[model samples]
Target: MWRDPGAPADSFYEIRPECTDVPKSRFRIKAGKTLSARKWHAAFSPEGYLDIGKTLSRIHRGGIHPSIRGEVWEFLLGCYDPKSTFEERDEIRQRRRTQYAEWKEECRQLFPLVGSGRFITAPVVTEDGQPIQDPLVLLENNPDGGAIVPPQTPQDNNGMGPPSTDAANKLEKMTDKGVIQWMLTLHQIGLDVIRTDRTLVFYEKKENLSKLWDILAVYARIDTDVGYCQGMSDLCSPMIILLNDEADAFWCFERLMRRLRGNFRCTDSSVGVEAQLSNLASITQVIDPKLHQHLEHLGGGDYLFAFRMLMVLFRREFSFCDSLYLWEMMWALEYDPDMFWLYEDAEETSDKSEEAKARLKSIRHYGKYERENMKNASKSSEEPPLPISVFLVASVLKEKSATLLQQARGLDDVVKILNDVNGNLDAKKACVAALKLHKKYLKKAKKP
Candidate 1:
């Protein structure tokens, strides 16, 4: 009734030359160096307080080194507060790992295959807790995780036979909505997992692939509000690879999702990235009216062509390594020091004195570009401004303005032009140009 976790995976990911050729990211390093490990350690007090303000500043100008990216990301993503001491963080880490193990056990109770070091590409059960007997869906363990092929064990007739006594009892016992939703999403997760970053050597190990599936599955179990979406694997994959510890990677992905969940929330009338696209249209109209008018004339005013870039954070447009580099650069530049407390939703800040509280709100933590926006941004707090990512999309648009305006006679041409930048876009220069374009757009937008 279940695939053996120790069974031969029958799947493998081969490294391609394109995957290894990482582009150099020297982010106009005239101001300061990339946040090296030494600087990272020095920022921490002897008692274990982290100087996040200084840390964010250096990271903004220059990105963090890969050796320490996952650890640094925990702070930036608000997994752990910079104010927490070494012992406190250690305790928190242990508690989180314990919590994650409990979650996996809970899921395993319902579906014994969850932590089995293998994932399903097809549904195993229905909403009513009955087994799905569709033999055609019994897919093979394809090397690339591609869709629909011959079964691995054709002699077994591609049938996932009736649930065994233990499995039947487990499914019949769980009648809760959360468990039901979790069961429904498992097959979808399997399908996406196979397609997610299959070209990387990191995914060659079947256990590594199962590790990612486990993280996503557990995440789905906890974050019931936004239970597993298609593009999430792309976001979660980097965390698993970056943070070797599965629990740490899960928490990191959770924290990262806190900032990005809005992009995944969709409604009847609009997709999640709609707000960013609206902002992009406004930005283009203000900063480059000529190009905006041309786009509108071409019926490309909605700016949906750039949706994939904003949706996956340009994971598709840039090389894998460059994508990570670009994420740190963008996150560093857009950092807000008060973000930690805001993200934590902590009430303890009220207990601190004015001086102590002021440190948390320090503008020094903001990047040069972010500091400018904070100074000149509208005072109305009702409507928060668009994220820096929208501005980054605008920057990409402006970079390709000439080609788009001239050659983009139709929407397809625009898509082709942007897609052509795949693996060629410079991560550093993209950050530099985004900040510059953001400043220019703000000035132009303020005009009467």
Candidate 2:
């Protein structure tokens, strides 16, 4: 039940790399050069052959310029690989658009309302692949232009003379029970969509709202298991606002969902927020046993309160713009320069330098070890190049530990305290704190 406070405030948070001694106010991109679209394109070019690690490091040290936020975000979100040529990415983009359109068409076929009144009757096919006639077309061709009368219901048999045209009209308005039950999520999705980013003028338009609904509805149909969740609208609103093309925005959101799908799974057998909450608790117990004991005493040892923050990656905790900044920085730090080439075929061993060969051998060994020990590992996936959102939750709790221990006597106090931090968090400080705690946890975990 987290609530977003309209638009983000004008304040900016300055984040610096873990080792940087530069003052927060003075933080800028690497070497003080701005990361414009031209510079980004050059760095990602095949001819330039710039190291992606170096480029991302520059972006991490100095944020991308405002003019190129949209373009740069696609790279960070894994929509395109650094090694892919512009032409290659364009082809991929077109393919993705086609795929998204097919999903939308599927939605329209299953739920006729999604057609936005563009089509009166949805096309259907019989089991043998025969096309069904359009009912609306038949109505349009009728000379009388009269309503299609429906058969009398049992209630109409009450010795009340032959049913009137009004009764037939009401009866003819059929309810697609199957479709209604299948799409029961429409109501919840609509509610959340309207509430999402309410402060933005873009969301006020009916067409924009419908576009959001269409994307969510189609996605729900595509991934029936996960379907539509409450917080998904919050995650998607930013993408809709930033990306112009609906297809492109849907693809970007899809990629993001791949990384975050674990958070939304609510089934008993699924490793979802409960698993992450356990990790957060373990981290807390080790780092600050006193606070952990206090929380335990207050019946919050489960750490359920951190659910919303981790579920949406702090979208409700920070302002909209700050959330974007935090996500970009997190993605940059998590970017693995070798990820692209890891699964691809390598050249002949003789052609590689000894140093290069050794690096490749090490990477292969690490991958093998990771795959073998993944079950026992605390992280659900391979260890990220940087810490994930769980650490940020730990950081926030640690930052407010003093206040909680001093004044919080029960669970309600803790909830109130966290609610107050909704839109007032400093992203840079939270990140720095999280990084420090991450190092500490790593050192502790390595102890025999």
Candidate 3:
């Protein structure tokens, strides 16, 4: 967590007047009887794109235009469906249904692998070397099951073979251990299955969202206790669509699920989400005190914008392709594919474990540096976090903060600031600024 800068309450930071000036002829103005005007008009029109379709493709093959950035971004991000033909749509639907069926079957088959057969008890070591309790035994075990010996008569209870207290303690201990192993097994297998599952990525069609929803619903049913949450689908949907290999995507999502399961624990309270939000708020306060103050004043500074990012791992804010790019970058930068599950200190005899641990520490250290660098870069650019929309919100204010401070008189001023940014800000620049702001906050948070 980071400390907030003690900025004066009455006065706020000001933007230089030079920063507020809109340049003359910022965008070329159309004039009657002008060739440039005619060219600009034609190029900017939606229908004009049809006329120079091949030419547009050729130019885009080299690079892309800023004018068509939004559509182009959507397309690149796999959120756009260029194949509008009837046959193509039907094919996508057919493939999607098949994928769902295949997923269901896979889950059914995988169930046995996760079940705890006749043994009914799995050994687990606690830090203190005491056997922990299991919840399943307490849940499913019944005195009527006939597995337990009959209780002694009142006369025999006066001198039973074993004391009732000892018997109860042993039962409780067994129950705890059973539940722990059950949970651990569920965690491990669930992660493995989700990580490997994959499906077609063409589910971005509005109608396909419901089908995608169904797939996630099935996962929730499989584990009703955890059920589903906002971010799980966001993470799973992309993998299903992009990989086109259900098993592969399932396992990948599974691996992610293992690490992230804590985020979705349905114990009635959202403690995990709150803690993350608090951390984000603290970081923001430390790095960009002015922006933090503005948000706090505006009633938007508790880091609510980060909720989706933290939950979905940045799926909603970025296009699917860009999200993948960012995710892969994050995974590569932060997690080691080869050294996963290697503990910091373990009594393993394998030589590879030693090698893995060294690599693990190096990667962990490197990830910290990379995260800090990324945060700094985003702040310098006055951007927000790529994974969270708040950075973009903060950037708009930062860029226009001076103007806003001068123009805004109170809460209405903040509202006006938000109003102006609604759909008017460039997503790319906003993303850049978000990254800059994150780094800036992180750096400030490190100060004594």
Query: At residue 394, what lDDT does model 3 achieve?
Result: 48
Off by over 4 Å in 2: 1-34, 46-51, 115-182, 268-271, 337-387
**What is the lDDT for 188 in model 2?**
52
lDDT of 2 by residue, 75-119 (tens): 667676555566766887898899898988877666455636221
Q: Comparing candidate 2 with candidate 3, which one achieves the higher TM-score? A: 2
Residue 214, model 3: lDDT of 37
RMSD of every prediction: 7.0, 12.7, 19.9
- Tens-digit lDDT track for model 1 on 258-333? 8888888777787777888888899999988898999899898898898888888988877566677788878777
Off by over 4 Å in 1: 1-32, 127-129, 133-137, 140-146, 149-170, 173-177, 345-356, 378-380
Candidate 2 lDDT score at position 212: 78
Model 3 TM:
0.43
lDDT ranking, high to low? 1, 2, 3
Find the candidate with the highest lDDT and give its number.
1
Candidate 1 Cα deviation (angstroms), residue 444: 1.5
Instruction: Estimate the TM-score of every prediction.
Output: 0.85, 0.70, 0.43
